[model samples]
Target: MNTAGIGGTDATGTSLRRLADALGTEMMWAGARDRPIGEVVIAEPGDVLADLPGALVLAVGARGADAITVVRSAAEAGAAAVAVRAAPGEDGALTPQVKAAAERAGIALMGIAASVRWDRAEADIRGVLERGAADGTSGHRGDLFSLAQTVATLTRGVVSIEDAAHRVLAYSDSGDEADELRRRSILGRTCPEPYLAHLRQWGVYRRARTGEEVVDVEELPEMGARRRMVIGINAAGRPLGTVWVQEGTRGLAGRTEEVMRGAARLAASQLVDHWFQGDPGARLPSRAGLAHGLLTGRFNSGALAAHLGIAPNASATVVAFDLREPESGDAVSQDARRAEAAEIISVHAASYRRSAMVAQACGQVYAMLPERAAAPSSEGLLTRWAEDLVSALRHHLRTPVQAVVAGTAPRLDDIPAVKLRGHHGLQVLARTPERQVATHTALTASLMVRDVLGLLDRHSEIRHPGLDVLARHDDAHGTEMCRSLLLYLDAFGDVGRVAKDLNVHPNTLRYRVRKAVALAGLDLDDPEHRIAAMLQLRLSREEPGTSPFPGG
Candidate 1:
């Protein structure tokens, strides 16, 4: 945890003045402006008593008299200050009783914005506490949140860090200058779908997610989105996230991009470090667990939907992410890379959609997009988001990340089937690497072929027994009959091509082909036999040492 409060270092700790600046929007309820805060404690609504001397108590889930009771107890505990949520837009005007309690107990009181989430508030306070104790000075802490503040100051704009998926990570406070879009995003802990859609419509997300140069966004009045300047954060050619500077009530400062570019590089390093070490204090992975449950049908979709704050029957946009790696790569490194990709997707999912859930299943990362209770048009929005996600992952992972959309599942029960389609869609994409993102509907023909190949791969009884007989003949005699026959069929009986391909004589190829047919009692003239042979041979390529009979 980082230290709490800023500036005016004291024998106890930093003063409240520095603390208020550390928390850009926290107002004074009744606290001494110079109260020294040495530590920060998270107070449960009813239980605030502890040996919390010189600590700033953040009373969670408490309001009015309930919060005042904690303040009284904290003061008795010798706490330096207690910060409570103020009524929205009213500062501490309605908390006179709370203030009176603090005054009587000789304890300082502080008012954090009601709109500020308790968890987020605690995070900010923790940053101040952890950093302050390290330096024993400056209220300012060197963390992502403080960096957000520094970026905001340099650009004279509201600043935030967003991953390639457009999820806002830690954003700075712009007070009254913040627009409705930023306010709602902070309040809900995600950017609104409609607003993100608006940005995508103008290709703003593309340039921001893919490139390192600063990209500008004009005000989108239709969506109530303010202008924003986006610069991609990159390290070693892999995107970490983006540094976003939004125009507040004030215009941006001069030479903003020059300073922002350097800050962006620093942010990328910090982000990469954070990914490697991670925050122990981050919220539990309940959302991910619920998502995994939904993907694997381990939990009732209705219940999971309720937990994720989605409607009971909302449609799910299922997209599967597959990380491309070498076939012979170390298994440990491959698993590690997959885990890293999952982490990258999961972090962005938190702030990308209020209900977005990412889970790993069958060695692939699956994201259940924001379940939309609205019209079906929202699927288009989700699709666009998925496309951008693929692009972002390519930049961040620096690998061929194949994403397959399974289309929208109208019912929760159908999501598993949809997930299967996405899984198969990835298989179809594996055969065609020319494109990275594809819809299941777009590859129907290819998927059908895959299904046929899968049948041959899975059920050996349905295969022509002749092929197995022919393969045994080759294994026993060291002959190339089956290989010649496969080549002959592949070339449509073009003897010259087959012989040249094998560096064998044309007469030798024909003799071997005839011998393979005779040994297996194979009917080369039958179209069905030829088609089955072609597919089975293709499947054999996937199974080493088992050619002429796949999955044998």
Candidate 2:
């Protein structure tokens, strides 16, 4: 049959011989090579009597079995053909009885090379069947098929288009000059192993993921190809796939690049359309986009709540996860890692009955969870939930994940501010020792002081009188009196703990605290004065200038 006859003009069905050839296998005994195969099946032992009319049956584990009985049973079951794995270097593996049974029953018998993986063989046969069906119905006029043919005709080179995962979606079949690599890739419906290795070695996958529009490979070793060009098909800055053209001995012209780019754009549209048609929401803005709008205060509370399926006045908490990768990792690996982490988080969050709208933004995955109105204590529950999530993520991913839980927002409109607070918690945690979970409340004082210092015009103005006095005394005397006082107050006057934290003797720390209080003229016994001193001390560390207190 001609190429057009095999995949174009014919409409009956794919023949047994065509299926075997597509799999790169041969018929052991050709009973009826022209018989049309309607479907493919992988049959196990004792399944020979299964109803598989007009289907090509692959009998796995057929070695050392009763071949005659299996073949006759398949034929009785209305199978078009039966294929068995051939033992290496054993040409006469199929017994005479098996051949006679196949011939008498009018069933085609085929032998697949032991070296061919069953999965690849099955995929190849499926591809052939799909092409045959398309041709029989539409006759070389399908969008993807026509695009492939056009690319080949224009460049006079082999063409293949693959999705991001390297699965072959379409390819042009140029008759005689098609190389071995192209043949294998097209038949298996995926890139060949050796070629994938080569691409990885040259960092092609990394460059493709970095949003590069055009990538040129000067040479592909051992493929008998001179050069190749790869064009990335993208939508909304995310890479969809790539179009690859292999230049043969006849080099491509200057205009070939421009033409290929145009073709790539068409292919991208087709891919995106297919994706949207498959999943209706893909055409709409993604959850990430919505979350970003909320974070940037771009959407009103009512609209955002309606979209998120929450009440306008509902309280919510933002849980942010920072998925870190090694500095040496490439962009491709980093993206894969992040995606894996996000999927795990989504699954776990659902299991907890916390239906979260997860989104990726600012190098973190944010899950905005609505708090139940009747819950007694939302913050405590949220903190504990974050701790559990961090533990689960670490156990599954085998890497440390930092989780920051923001305080509950009073209403949906306050989510943007709460998200900012969550990020601030993350920043504070970064300066401390390694921790799995950090809540906004634990760092409230630090955050408040940082916020105040950020607005100060100059560092020379002291925020509190007592803190200023201690600061000057420490600077002049070259002593850690200010540090001792802050630690003493932070510990709630627990001298032993404060001394240990400061790495100093308890008596020394106590003396410094008393001397510092006396020098600053502060009364530590009064609740109001102690609160005022703590606030001033916290602010002093952030900025060396004026006290925020009204009076000395």
Cα-based TM-score, every candidate: 0.49, 0.47
Candidate 2 versus truth, CA RMSD in Å, comes to 20.6
What lDDT does each candidate get? 0.69, 0.66
Shift in Å, residue 356, candidate 1? 3.3
lDDT of 2 at 370: 70
**Per-residue lDDT over 163-248 for candidate 2, one digit per residue giving the tens place of the 0 to 100 score:** 77776667776566566676666545567678888889987777766653567877755774447788877778777778888776
* Candidate 2 lDDT for residue 45: 61
Instruction: Give lDDT tens digits, candidate 1, residues 171-211.
Output: 77777787878776654345778987777888866676564
**How much is the lDDT of residue 143 in candidate 2?**
49
Worst 10 residues of 2 by lDDT: 1-10
